[model samples]
Target chain A: MGNCYTFKIKNNFPELELLCAEINEIARESNFSEQLLFSLNVCLEEMLTNIIKYGYDDNRPHDIEIRLEIDNEIMILTIIDDGHAFNPLEADAPDMKSDLQHRQLGGIGIFLTCKMADKLSYERKDNKNFLKILLAPHVAAL
Target chain B: MKLTQLESTDRITNLLLSGSLDISGVKDVEMDFARLASGKRAVVVDFSGVTFIASLGMRMLLSAAKKLDSEGGRLILHSVPPLVETALETAGLTMVLPVVKDAPDAISLSQLQR
Candidate 1:
């Protein structure tokens, strides 16, 4: 059974390094798939960036705590933020087929997060929004 | 971590990006793309040089593309290097964003009367 690990980061962008690095080290040590590690990091970045940009409405910065656990072949990532209650999963889905010139730039984070993860869910628990993403075991390319 | 202008035409802009597009490079790329979005209706981001893109990099593209879209502009991607393409494809960005064969094609397509 792989153990879970937790780390805290300020809403600032650079603080994301700590979380990514930690996740990378753990994944390497645990022999997680490379694709799994990369996807997890990307998913984390998408969620954390949203929290940093919109969670507090660009006001005073706050903190985000990230937790990761692996069971069997699945990897789970949980992100919690104490800032203003906002849910990335609730953001309106993008009109993906729209012409490039007509598309909007925002919401790509949530879009990519949901797309990359095998399983994704969110909820506001005790006034904190917990965003979770799961990655399935890597499958060889066909 | 590395970005070099691959080609620039009146209709499209292609950039060869390499290394990791993560927290370290997001801000700079955002600022760079912000400037590129100015006065341009279509942009093509060539990922031929890129190997990996994290959430931070994806956010940069999303936000930048949104800005361009709001202005009645667009961003297309081309020649996504295999390593980086995995990330984008898995993210379903390949389906959402317009992708082309190479820089010239992207530019030509961007210039098409739409």
Candidate 2:
């Protein structure tokens, strides 16, 4: 890995702002493409929002760890959360063809991330959910 | 996020939004957006100033649009960036919250509903 950035945030929405700021700073320092930066933001928001919103059973504080690696021509993102076991790769696809009245709000975040990312994988290790995303040179922006 | 009503009347409502429509940003303007967009008038939003959007943002827009449709009103978005437009299309929202080229087009489209 060329440069690795790691962060740990409490599982809350307010805590996400700080991490997003750090990612913005990293994007500035590395001069990453706008598409990639947008994708990165989307990935973090979607994945972590799921963990923070629906990852736990009891009302207790939790910590989520995020790691971003800027290798030569690819960007690697790894998120670790001590929430319940859930695989994003198996998420139901959002209803993209539905009309406004019948549209479903669920799964749009993960669906957008999947459309933007080049590759994505999920694993449960040590009672934590590990979701890794790889974005190559192409972000598949339309 | 910042949401400003450029103009508002019984016939139409025009608003300008500038900021990332993330979780916090959504919280910042969702109430005002809903209030303005829920009225019995065509709502036009200028999206050129908006730099980023995601699912939360999409939900906000769709909710307003759905409310408008139920009330016989409509919401239109104009001057969107390509990337932001991509996200909207990905969510298939351009149909209900139609995207136009500029303020004039958005205003015209909104008025067309009347």
Candidates' chain B TM-scores in the order shown: 0.80, 0.93
**How accurately is candidate 2 docked according to DockQ?**
0.76
DockQ of every candidate:
0.35, 0.76
lDDT of 2 by residue, A8-37 (tens): 999998889889988888876787788888
In model 2, the runs with Cα more than 4 Å from the true position are A138-142
Q: Over the stretch B14-107, how does candidate 1's per-residue lDDT look in tens digits?
A: 6666666777766546676677755556877767766568655765776677777677778788888665777666555666567788877887
Candidate 1 residue pairs that clash: A100-B74, A101-B73, A101-B74, A104-B66, A105-B62, A105-B66
Global lDDT for candidate 2? 0.87
Cα lDDT tens digits for candidate 1, A27-133: 88877766676677778777887777777866776778888887767788888888777767678875556554454445656777776788778888888888877
Error of 1 at B65 (Å): 7.2
**Each model's lDDT:** 0.72, 0.87
Each model's TM-score, in the order given? Answer: 0.71, 0.94
TM-score of predicted chain A against the true chain A, for each candidate: 0.84, 0.93
